[model samples]
Target: MDLEAFRSLPEWPMILRDSWETNAGWWQAGFTEGSDVEYEEQIKPIVRVGLGGAHRILDLGGGDGQLARVLAADGASTVVLDSSAAQLQTAHHRGSSVVLATGAALPFRDGSFDGVLICLVLEHVVELDEVLAEVARVLEPGGRFLLMLNHPILQTPGSGFIDDVDLGEQYWRLGPYLREDIQMEEVDAQIFVPFVHRPLSRYLNGASARGLMLVRMEEPPPPPGFVARAEEYLQVQEYPRLLVLHFERRP
Candidate 1:
């Protein structure tokens, strides 16, 4: 379906969830274990460092329990939560404590977890403020919330690498960074995934308003594996593709 057609649907969120349900198998095959280079090399290490020393952790929207497994291996009690039952089933079979739930309404008590991590999931969620509030509510005082995102400015719909033959130079071109909108990303033939784009200020301000203070932020360049996948990417190797934010719950 085209973007205009999708925008006309009243239950876009449900449609998005159904799309994920249908693509769960494909995602499990592609991203499970160490298959995705970006996840294994850059995202995982940053999350490990940001949420270190936290015993009770919640991996919100942690599909297939990849990150949760890593935390569990480090001896932290980790719970993997996702709205897709098919994804949670794979995680459960892989020995992760799985919960079928949405981020906006977590199935837990206030201050239930010492650490919460959401990686590459927020872009799909429509209720950003509600999710952030729930994240703050479930995190205990001084708890850390590790958030990972495809860099907003770089991943915008129209953003991409540009090769200028006339100028004999190659650079990255950014999309409408300030425009906040949801669009359908065609991941495979006949399969589409919805992605919501919001500026950096929205995330920072939303978290801060919900009593979550930013402790640290990291913008990591493309990993070696990512750069090696394409020759043109080498030209923009210094540009970061991932944005990791570490926030703490205020006491």
Candidate 2:
């Protein structure tokens, strides 16, 4: 769908949630524990360290509680909150403390969590400011907010590996990096997921305005196992596919 089409839909959020609900089974099966190499090797490690010793953790948009289960295994009281009931059901069945809610309006008290994690979720959310505000509100003083995303510049719509035959070299091509728009990504044949493409500054500045101070930022390349899956990725191995920002709630 085009930008105008997406904007015209007043129930976009609900529509998005419905899409996830429909794809919940597929997603669960595909990313089940240790199935995704990037999550197992890179994302999980970084998130764990970013959260530090926080006992009360909130996994925002935590679908099926994959990360939440890992954090809970480490003895943290990890609560998985997601908008899709189908996703939350799987999480609950997997022994996770699940909450059905949206990130824009968290059904929790102020300073409810010591650490908040929103992994690869913001891209799907149009209400970025509201979600960030809710994140800041729910995090206690000095709490960490781990914001993980598919690298905005690298993963932007139309961005991909360009195999230039004339040059006999492969390079990464970036799409309309500065232009923020919503695009649909096909997960399966005829199954499309919507993503909001925003510049890097948008996230950093938005969080900063919400009293979420940036502590550290990591732009890591694709994991070995991920690159090993395809020959094309081997050439652009240095390019980061993930952007992780560790932010602290300003006291």
Give the clash count for each candidate.
0, 0
Model 2 segments beyond 4 Å from truth?
Answer: 1-5, 165-169
lDDT of 1 by residue, 38-105 (tens): 88887788878888889999999998999998888888999999999999999999999999989999
Tens-digit lDDT string for candidate 2 (60-86): 999999998788878899999999999
- Candidate RMSDs in Å, in order, are 2.4, 1.7
The alpha-carbon lDDT assigned to residue 193 of candidate 2 equals: 77
Task: Estimate candidate 1's alpha-carbon lDDT, on a 0 to 1 scale.
Answer: 0.88
Each candidate: what lDDT? 0.88, 0.88
Per-residue error (Å), model 1, residue 94: 0.9
Error of 2 at 146 (Å): 0.5
